[model samples]
Each structure stands twice: as C-alpha cells, then as structure tokens.
Target: MTKTEQFSKLLREMEECGEDEQKQKIEEMKELINEMNTDDFRHVFTKEQFNKFEKMIEEKKISLENAALLLKHVGYCKKLKNIWIDGLKESLLNKRLELIIIAEDEKKKDEKNENLLIDLCECYISLSRGFPPELLSICVPHLLKKALMKGKNEEIQKEVEIVLLALSNIDHYGVNQALYLDEIKEIIQHHQEHHNLTQLAYQSAWLFLSYRLFFNDKSFKEVVANELHFVREAKRELVELTRQVDWMKKEENRGKKEEKELYIFFGWFSSIGNFLINCDLWNEEFAGLICSITRLLRVAKDNYRDIRRWFISILKTAAQKGAAKVDDLLKGGAVEAVLEEILQPAIDGMTEEDCFIFFLNISERLNEKEEDEKEEEERKAAKMEIFEKLEKEGYEDAIFSFHEKLPKAVFHPSFMFVPKNLSDYLMHL
Candidate 1:
C-alpha cells in the first residue's frame, strides 16, 4: 500500500482499537509520517487526503472514550497531548478537545492549563465564522450563563467575563432571545440576597437592558420593570444599611464621605426610567419612581457630582423625548431648576474655549424659544445658502422646488390674492 493508503488503513483500524490501542495506532501513524522523507511524503499524499487524515485523527482523539476500543494493549492518553498540540488543524472538528481540557477541575488546576483553557475559549469564539444562527442561539448563551453560574474561582470568573464579553459582541437579537427571563431573575435574586455580587449586579442589570432593547420583545418589558423594582428596593435597603454602619456614620459626621451604595439605586433608577419612557407607557408607580430619582440625585449631588449630572441629563432627555409622559415632571419644573444649578458648574468647570462654545450652545437653545419671524427668515436663508452650495457641488436634484412644480396663482386684483384655480396650488409638489 502507498503511504496514503497506510494512513487510511490506520484510520480505519482506529475504530476497532481500545483507547490504548487507538493511541498506539495514532502514534504509529505519526511516526510513519514523521520518518518519511518530507518531499516524497508531500509528493505521495494529495492535499485533500492529508486534510481527511488530520480530521480523522483529531476526531479519534477527541472521542477516545466514546468509541469502543480496537486494540486493548496500547496507551492513548500519552499520545493525546501531542496529537492535540501538533497533529490537528485548529478547526471546528478539533474544538471539542478544548471543551474536554476545561471540563474537569483537576485538568484546570495548573495555572498554565487554566490560561490555555481561557485562550481556547476565546479562540473558538473568535474564529467561529459561518456558524449558523440556530447553533449560536443555543450555544453561546448556554456557555456564557453556565460559566457565570458555575465559575466560582477568581480565575474562572475572569474567564467567564471574557466569554460574556465575546457573546455580547455578536450583536444579534437571536442571541438575546436565547436567554430566558428565569435565568436573569435567578442571577438578580442571588446577587441581591447574598451581597457578594453587587458589582456584578450592576453589570448584569445593564446587560439585561441591552438584551431587552436589542430583542425588542414587549413581553420582556414587564420582566424589565420587575427587575427595576427589585434593584430599586435593593438600593434603598443598602442606603438604610449604610446609615447604620459605624464607619459610614463616622465619615458622614466628619463630612469626609457619603455612602457609595446610594449610587447603585441611581443606576437602577435610570434604567427603569428608560424602560418607562421608551414604551410611552406610564403608571402612578413610574411617576413616583422618577420623583424619587430626582430627590436621590439632589441628595447625592455633593458627594457624587458626576452621577448627579448624569441623572439630571437622563431626566432632561426623557422630558425632551417623552414630552407627553414627562409633562407633569416638566410642570414640576425639576429639569429647569436643576439645569440652572448645573449651568454654572458645567460652565465654570470648563476651560475658557469650551465655556465659550458651551455659552454659544446655550445662546442657540435660548434663541430657539423666541418665535421671531425675522430670525426665522435669516436662519432659512442661511440654510438655503448651505443647501445651494451642496447642490452646486454635484448633488443632483438635492433640493426639491415646490414653486417650480406648481402653477402660479394669478392675482386677479378683484378679491384677495388667493388663487382662483385650486388645482394650481394643489400641483405645487
């Protein structure tokens, strides 16, 4: 038999060997391939044959325990590492080996092995292209949530975070749909009662928001609302707890600090605000929620200036976008009052040049309120000039002319200057 035939024979025989016999056969095949003159071996085996042999070897090693053993006398695990590192192409068929290495705690005991597991997870995630949506939908979230729930050690936690970040990058609704509300609820519940994962709590809340928004399923909105309520309650509980903590009280007395946990509620409230605002849906509870958020911002201002500003910005944006829903809040004039307070700090905090630019923006916004026709005409003229300039620069038919298309209304000088012919005006477009 030719060398190619011999490789094929070994692969065929591999199925009959016991785990040890299979390893021996694999080693024998490797030795035959290694010992042969490189040029002659290359000349004998076609590229396709070589690829098939490599794929077979990779599958055989990865499935060692699953397949019935052919030869009972040879060692398999000894050859497994070399086959993994050297024999197989880093293809999807060989990806299972990575899962095997990372499956058990013992295999991952060594730091280097742990690192390798992380690297392989990352590599598989990165290189997995042409992966069908159905598979990705089932697989990615399963792996991510599994890692997050199961990974307790610091190293494993870090690895799990990396996997989640990778999953987040896929940017598809199907990916988010794969996760159930129950899973998210469990995570939130555990984090809330345990106090062990407050940081993760915040991260997961934002991630859940992203998941819901991108998925755009209304059913999840109620779930989001419930999550928001839980988070809000947690925040209140934290603040009350902090007030009781001795060190926190001492710092408060010295005017040296305030409770940091207060901002957790702020974060949660902002997300809740978004959910309420976007659906154009509101209830008495939501109204009270915003009011409480506004009060919280006012209280947290001295200690957390940045967060205070951010909360106010969220309110302003909501009032602007959800104008009808926010009419009551605007009537309360919380935004206008807060803006006045923010104005000086926002301006005073800026460099001279930035302040000047900011002042100009303020002037523009202030100017927008005046319903002066002259200013409007001037702005229109300026806009027309810009449009004309753009049109002249080869933007064909960039501007449509209402006047040109419509017939001119004749002034009969009899009654008002209104057109006698109605169709003339109607054809303006």
Candidate 2:
C-alpha cells in the first residue's frame, strides 16, 4: 500500500485498535511513507499508488461502509491526481448500476429495504461529483422525483434529502431539471404544504429548484408565468414565510433551524420576485405578492435593502408595463417601505424619474378619485412617513414640477398623492 492508503487504512481501523497497538504498528511502518502536504492534511497520490489501492478494492469484497467512507475521504482530499481519482470514480460508477437495480427491485416490493436504499443513495451521493455531470447525474433526477412522489407516504421520504444532496453535487447546469420540469413542478405543487418534508429538506429542494428556474429564461417563464401555476406556488411559500415570521415573533426561544428556513424562503421569494417582473402576465397574483413580500419586511432584515429593491423594481416595471394595481402598493405599505426604508438617506440610483413615475401613477389614480374618504385617509396615514421623508429630503420642487406636468392627474403635495393609470393603460395590452 502507498503511504496514502496506509493512512486511510489506519484512519478506517482506528476504532478497532488501541492507541498503544497503533503506535507499535506505526513504529514498524515508519519507512513506508512519511511525506505529507504541508498546506492541508491531504496527499497527492501517484497513479502507481492509486492503482494498487484500486486493485485492492477490485479484488477484495469491501464493505459498503468502508468503500463509502474511503470514497468520501478521497473526494475531500482535493489534491489527488485526476487519473487516480478517475480510476476510483470509474470503479464506483461500475458498481453503481448494480446498486441502482437492486434498490429499484427492493422499491417495488412490500416492506422495501429502507436501509439498503438509504445506503445505496448515500453511495450515489459520494459518486455524484465528476466532470460533465453525466458520470453519475443522468439517473438522479428520476430518483429524486420518485422520492418526492412517494415522500408523502414515508416510503422514499427518507431519501429526499439524500437525493437532493446527490443531485446538488452534479447537474451544474439544470439539464436533468429541464428534462423533468413537469414532474418537478408536480412534486413542488404537491409538497407546497410541505406535508411530510422537513423544513431543511423542503428548502433544500426549493433552493435547488429556484436556482434552476431563475437562471434559464425560457424555463423560468414556462414554470412561473405559463400554464404551470408556479406563480401561485410562489405566493404560497411567501405566505408560509410570513406566517413563520409572525410565529417567531411570539416565541421566546426560536429554533435556529426555523429561522434558517425563513431566511431560505425569503431568499427564494426575493429572487423570484425579481424574476416575476420579466413575465408578461402581471395580474392579481402580483397584488397578493405585494402584501406577502411587504409582510416579510421585518423578517428579511438581513436582506432589507435588496428585498426593498425587488419590491420597488417590480412595482416600477409593472407601473411602466400597465398591469400594475397602484392601490395595492399603498394598501400593502409598499410606499412606506420604499421611501422610509429604501430611499432613506438618499440612495444614488433613485433619480427623480423612479420617484416621479411612482408619483405619476399615484396621480393617475388620484384623478379618478376612486378611493373614498375613509380609504384616502388610510392611504395618507400609511404614507405619512413617506410624506415626512420627502419633505425632509426637499423634494417639493420636484413634486411641483411633476404635478404641473400632470395637471389632470390628482396631486396632493401634502401626502404626495398622485393617480394611477399605468396599469389602466396597459390593461388593454
């Protein structure tokens, strides 16, 4: 055995031998290989050394436990030579087909072999890393979707996180996800309630899925805005996040995992919120989105500014695009969040246009006088901070100029009230 293999064997066998016994053995093997990589606890194994170890694995009937551990160790080393690493990977891949068949067979039977499937999935996870992603990635999405489909029954639910971990290692591009988009969405739709899935498991899946959707433009549009109804699912997740946040507010001792899950949800929502602006169909769903996103303001403190940007940009684009409902922005406290939170101390990119168009939309809404006195008062109160902030920022001249430009549109300088009509104009579109 090479020095590296010897070390591996020693580490593997550490539990079985006493420290005294190991010391005597090490003394005898002192000449074997004392070299080490100084920067990290890793070794650059030569092909000859790797071949001998590879041959040992091939010839001997190794336990899955040891093989998995050894593979994990080799994968972690990072300094190993490519050929040697490829040799180990090839061995694992050759062994993988048989395991998959056996796991599939067991999956078909009553009282399926849970431990066997679990161990097999764990081994696959170990083998999932390699170039091209085709080495071990091709069959993973099928297994992941199957696991999710049966997840509610607890049959393959145990393997959900394992499959997620396995798939995450490969599929750098979402080739597998694209191939299985419908099934992916189906499982997501089914699990929207997170019935049997753990918070970690659910968010892990969403993190993976969100990355895929937000990245590829075509898939994203199809998944979210097209007939798929993923838009509604986004709202569902946002609602859950807000619910969890409110619950956390009441609890004295919040679990770190729960807070982590909320962050994951917020991260997902915030990314998707930006993505939603590009979709052609911005409708009532967005109105609900506003409230859900606004509710998350307190919970998303870490990402406050970015989330607020997404909020503002979405409204800005929708206002321009003509599908926006301006009243929802006010009712949802989006105005307050923008002026008080995002524009506070004067963000640079917030030129007069972004602020003016927002006011123009308000003026368009104001011209209609649709809001009764009661609703008007509530809008004023909700935007009081915005009003005060604008006054403090000295936007009176800009407001007067914008109001002069839009005489027909309603303009109340005191509360900076402006009317809508962007969405009204685009409604025909």
As a whole number from 0 to 100, the lDDT of residue 305 in candidate 2 is 46
Residues 320-412, candidate 2, lDDT per residue (tens digit)? 434345555765665555444433454435433455556545545543442579766654553454445456553444344443444353332
Query: Per-residue lDDT tens digits of candidate 1, residues 355-379?
Result: 2222222223323432778756654
Candidate 1 TM-score over all chains jointly: 0.39
Best by TM-score: 2
Which regions of candidate 2 are displaced past 4 Å?
1-133, 151-158, 165-178, 192-194, 199-223, 246-255, 270-274, 299-332, 343-429
lDDT for model 2, please: 0.48
State every prediction's TM-score relative to the real structure. Answer: 0.39, 0.49
Local distance difference test scores for all models: 0.42, 0.48
